[model samples]
Target: PGVWDVAAKDNRGIMDVAVFRLSKKYPRANSVMTHNLPDGGHVRVASGPDGMASIWDYDIVLMGVSHLTEAMNRYRAGLGEKPGRSFRPHVSEILKFCRQSDGGRQYEAVEAALRRLKQTTVEIVRRQRGKDGRPLRVTEGAGLINDYKAVSHEDSGRVTSVEIELPKWLYAAVVEAEHPEVLTMHPNYFLMTPGLGRFVYRLARVAAGKGEARWSFRLIHERSGSPDAFKKSSAGIRELIKANELPEYDLAEEPGQDGPILVMRFRGSFPTPSTDTAGP
Candidate 1:
């Protein structure tokens, strides 16, 4: 019955005949090609429009399946009651080995864990706030407050300026520590903020060796009677000397005393060009 079907050759054509004959001769071969056939059993004929036939052996495929089965069995055995529970024990064993090998470095491990946790927490907070909402504060202290005012000019709509007032005592202390001589040089002294200080220093440098160059110094209250008391005072005097190399100046013993004041003046000229007009 099979041979009759093979000879009938429906849409499958001659390939069916070749497959059937190969199957009959080699029941256990699992594949068939003319080159592998022995002696008289082999048959060669002219190539059809479909061309040559090739076969592949399934030995490697069978071997791969066997290996996969063995691996699955071993994995199941290791899991005991659990089917696929190797991951947790593997990780736990690794951690145990690390701890046993480097017991003294536990502090470093804890610190690393804390840092990771902090980063994750910060990320979560940022995600919760989104872009429009107020951001999370990382520090305990209050941040700086800014007060701005705008002034209008004839040519410009408005120019904005900011007034920043910090803790008075903190500013006073810093000034005292940084420039004590300002106390004796001028009764009324002002300490510029860090940003303004840079501009002031630049102006002072430019005015060097100019007519009556004036410099500003800082003063603090704490150095009332210390040896470094004179340091701040000297800085102020040095600035005054640079102002114009004044031959004579008076220094006061107390902060509020009337003494020599450093004055700075700025002068410039402006000129407009014009063409001559002819009269009729």
Candidate 2:
């Protein structure tokens, strides 16, 4: 758990697989992505009629997570209100939260993103323990969002407000779980340009925390759901290291048994001594 009183950026669950496309380009229609986790866990994302959801579309989920997490934090502190799965926020509020233009095009984009979230399905399977302490496989399959309703202005016909019903899994993880697997994100994350950059920041946030973490480029490529081949994917990682634009983390590369490895070291908002380490 993190400090609940101080204001900060949004939070997201530490999902091991990338459910949304990593690029801005529209994904091919009717595409399905699946990732096999090291511990035999599985994740599958199926596209909807609007095509696979892009990383930009995930901003809405971040908004929902932030709202619910704050509400839960306040409730736990004896606040009168409790968080719920359904969240109703004015459309303008969402736009501002995501740092987007408040105009017709952005509003339409938001509506489209919401529709894709409602239609796309994500299925996850992982091994867990029951009350009896026996190993059991748990499977969850549902859309990114359960449902949504947008109300439009009478004259302008622009969407004024929206009510979003989050998936049970997400709601449970954020509000119901005893120790939620969520982490506070950097405010500049929403302004990131490269899609891979955004994904890597999230990976570092969850895996590295305030320490250092390393992963082979091969594993990152697979987890990223990148359509590029191994060579291209590795090259893209090298480019990321060169660009060095991600906020709150520094990227580097080192030799590995299989290939190159990505080194993510936490550098807080202010500079400090580097605690870099070497190894697998």
Candidate 3:
């Protein structure tokens, strides 16, 4: 287990094994990173290797998730063929499924996010014992899109549809029919503004599972890639608790010998939204 994507030793078996599987999957998602964070703003962890990442402030990552979810769901439910690196869908379809604001500006926003997805890249490393009883590092680059295409009208120059190339790693996760390893995102996920609420929600969804999940400030900060001072980071958690921003889960802070520990437990059964989750 020396090559685990996450350093399991850090948690000493306290963290759920499933949570560690979130590699850009966030419980099957990829990790995130880019800048420094502070007490008042997003905390950016200064330590760690290049692979550490946190949920992005913008919901664009969700946008990409929306696309990935669709094809994967279809494949899982036996609706569509297996997906290749490229996933193609229309602009309107992407909008409707995500329940996003519609208009020229909104369309433009999607376009911008698409650009970022193509550019953003994630490096994935997995571990397994080699034949010689040695651990191995399997590294692959997980870019959001390997290729992309947008069909636009000649006269208006408006994009009509889109085609995106998915990284191989993502395609494999979605196609893993044996364990059904897909992450189920909440319907209101897209509606959530990019901030502590969404951030906490993601961590809960990915790690909390169907029961109580515990994370220390250092662990969350490590995963969060937050740069805030320790006290400031704890304060940020308090703000989420008071606001009650997390959905389908309850947040509680307890006094630990070191400091306060954050625990997230299932509020009850998570209710799936009745919104349109399919392409139009």
Winning candidate number (lDDT): 2
Better of 2 and 3 by lDDT: 2
Query: What tens-digit string does per-residue lDDT give for candidate 2 at 1-280?
Result: 2222223333345444688888877564578888886668788889877888787888888877777767776686676498779988888788887778899888878898998887788888888789999999988898888999999877887898899999888888777777764666676887887888888988987788788999999999998999989998888888889988888889999999988899999988522213111001
Task: Flag regions of model 1 displaced more than 4 Å.
Answer: 1-230, 240-257, 268-280
TM-score, prediction 3: 0.69
**Cα lDDT for residue 180, model 3?**
31
**How would you encode candidate 3's per-residue C-alpha lDDT over 1-280 as one tens digit per residue?**
0111110001111112111211232321234453222322221121123232233312333444444555555666788776555655667656665566556666665565566555556453445678999977665565445557777778876778777665565545544434334455555655665345555666676678788887776566555444456677678888877776676788988877766778898776544433323311
The TM-score leader among the candidates is 2
The order of the candidates by TM-score, greatest first, is 2, 3, 1
Candidate 3 lDDT trough over 10 residues, lowest sum: 1-10
lDDT of 1 by residue, 1-280 (tens): 1111111001111111121111112222122223112122222222222222111111111111222222333444563231221111121222232222323343233223222211211000011243679654322111011111222334643222212222222222222223311111010111222212222322332343123344323321111111234555456444544543321222122233333333434232112112101000
Q: What is the lDDT of residue 210 in candidate 2?
A: 84
Predicted structure 1: clash tally = 13
Residue 52 local lDDT, model 1:
20
Whole-model lDDT, model 3: 0.51
RMSD of each: 46.4, 5.7, 10.2
